[model samples]
Target: MQQEKESAEEINELWSLYGENRSMEIRNRLVEHYLPLVNIIAGRLAMSLPSHVDRDDLIISGYFGLMDAVDRYDIKRGNKFETYAGIRISGAMKDELRSRDWISVSLRQKIRRYESAVVELEGRLGRSATDEELAERLEMSIEQVHHLERQINAATVIPLGEYMKSEAAIAVDTDPHRSAEYIETRETLAKALDELTEKEKLVVSLYYYDELTMKEISLIMHLSEARICQLHTKAMFKLRGFLANIDGI
Candidate 1:
């Protein structure tokens, strides 16, 4: 408990120093101070991903996110930098994961077709079809059909980033004021997210898009749950402040 308190205090101190646009001396101190925290996040993420993903690469990705959070955090809002940095770190990890080409477009399309056929069969027969049955209907080999089904199953298991764009894209024409305001807010938020560090971006994606809880996120990222919560809070503050600044302009 005491250690947790001390850690919180130390995080606050780093936020304070980074917020002031202080000299490199102060920034360097901040970086050195938070290395352990970033590493914790990286390590957690490394564990959550498959062996194909590199742990060291994730750690390096998180470091850059920490730097980005320090560079962009707003001190005037009394926001915690740890919170902001957390999101940046997660975003960075996700971006790197995406770059790995886990699934090809052709594979995705095949998976989609396989899923659609399964649903259709289930509707007609009121039961799941055997691999041979599906293969016969689809005019494909049983192995090929099974492979496509596996791809669909795997795709379902992967959590893609949720988009933060305006509901205007989905809204009806009935409520003009509400829809317009929503669109504007979404646009502003989107812009702010673009400014966030890659890791921060991933945090938002995991929390919002993946619909994962802080504890789940912590486990996935190999960081403490409290740290995940702090990162979320900081990201919120940064988003609000960034939108405010943009609105003023």
Candidate 2:
């Protein structure tokens, strides 16, 4: 407790100096103070990523986000700096992954086809489509379907902020700032989440809210990691599809 108090005092001092002078030296100190946050987020994201993705690269990408968060954070908001910085760092890493076309073009094409097949099959069946059903609809083997699901899981990394952004925006909007856009977006997200299965919801809750790694979640759920990945992918597709449909994007 004493050590934590000292660390907090150090952080407060750094923030005060940076806020007062806005000097590079103070800013650098602030960055150093929050650097562990970047590492934590990067490490967590790296755990679910493919082996080809370098964790060091994620940390490097996250550094920029830490700087940006330090520049933009408002102390009056009563929000923890660590919470704000973590979101920015994770978002930066995801943006870096997106810019690099982390998923191959061929794999992206397969993911698109799989998402479309799942949507169409679910619509026709009036239920969540099974892997066998999706395979039949797409005229692929069960193994192929599983492979595509795994690829989709590996390629897509949606941040929790993206999922909840609309609601957050709505919460912050004032009378003059309030708009139908935020409401619609929030509604769309709610509908999407409502459509998910209980198991999918549990996976999302454990992974995002509880901050558990995939291996940990798999152990708790008594399922294989691969199976958990597939469920996560399916849930993401449903949410993504709903947003796309509502926004016409």
Candidate 3:
């Protein structure tokens, strides 16, 4: 605890120094102090990405984010620098991935069709549709549906920074008036989560909330990694549809 307090004090001193002079020396020190944050976010993101995506490239992109955060951070905002910097770092990496357009146009179309089918079938059935039901509704074999679900899962394994922007996209204010919207969104998310099956819910919780790798989750759940991925994909689609219905997202 003492060590942590001392580290925080040092960082605050550096921040103060940089705020006063805006010198490269002080800024570089601040950057060095927070580089570990970039590594952590980059590492988590890399776990979800394909092996071909170079981890070093992600780290390099995230360095730019860290620099931007250092430049723009407001000490008076009452937000922790680490929290703000994590978002910026992860956002930078995601922007790099988006520029690459790793997921093909055809795959994107397939994902849209799959999401639409899921929404339609669930609405008509008045419940979460099973894999067989989804296959029947989409006029595809169960194997094909599973394959598409895997693809969707892979494509959707974006950093939490991007996930927050894409999924929430609402002002998170502390004032009662503005906060009401944020509260409602949280409630909607909770309700959508409740709609998921026990296994699907566990998968979502483990992957997102617990920050466990898919392999870790697979071992814990005693299921194949591929099966866990499918569950995550299904849960994400359901939550997206539910939120879309409520927020027109």
Off by over 4 Å in 3: 1-6, 76-78, 159-181, 245-249
Per-residue accuracy of model 2 over 1-249 as CA lDDT, tens digit each: 212333787777777777788889878778877788988988878876789999999999999999998997766556677766776788889888878777778987898898889888888988899988988988999988888888788777763345553344334435554557667776777788889999998888787778887789899999999899888898888878778755423
Candidate 2 runs further than 4 Å off: 1-6, 159-161, 165-184, 245-249
* TM values, all candidates: 0.46, 0.87, 0.81
Instruction: Estimate, for each residue in 98-162, the C-alpha lDDT of model 1 and write its tens digit.
Output: 78866668976775565566556655876445557778778899767655554443343223221
TM-score of 2: 0.87
Clashes of each: 16, 0, 0
Residue 99 lDDT in candidate 3:
88
lDDT of 3 by residue, 1-249 (tens): 212333878888888888888989888888888888989998988877777889999999999999998998766566677767777788789889888888888988998899888888878998778889989988999999888887788788662224443222233234575566666767777788889999998998887778788899999999999889888888888887667654424
Task: Determine which window of 10 residues in candidate 3 has minimal summed lDDT.
Answer: 165-174
Say which prediction, candidate 1 or candidate 3, comes out ahead on TM-score. 3
Model 3 TM-score, 2 decimals: 0.81
User: Alpha-carbon error at 37 in model 2, in Å?
Assistant: 1.0
Please report the candidate that would top TM-score against the real structure.
2
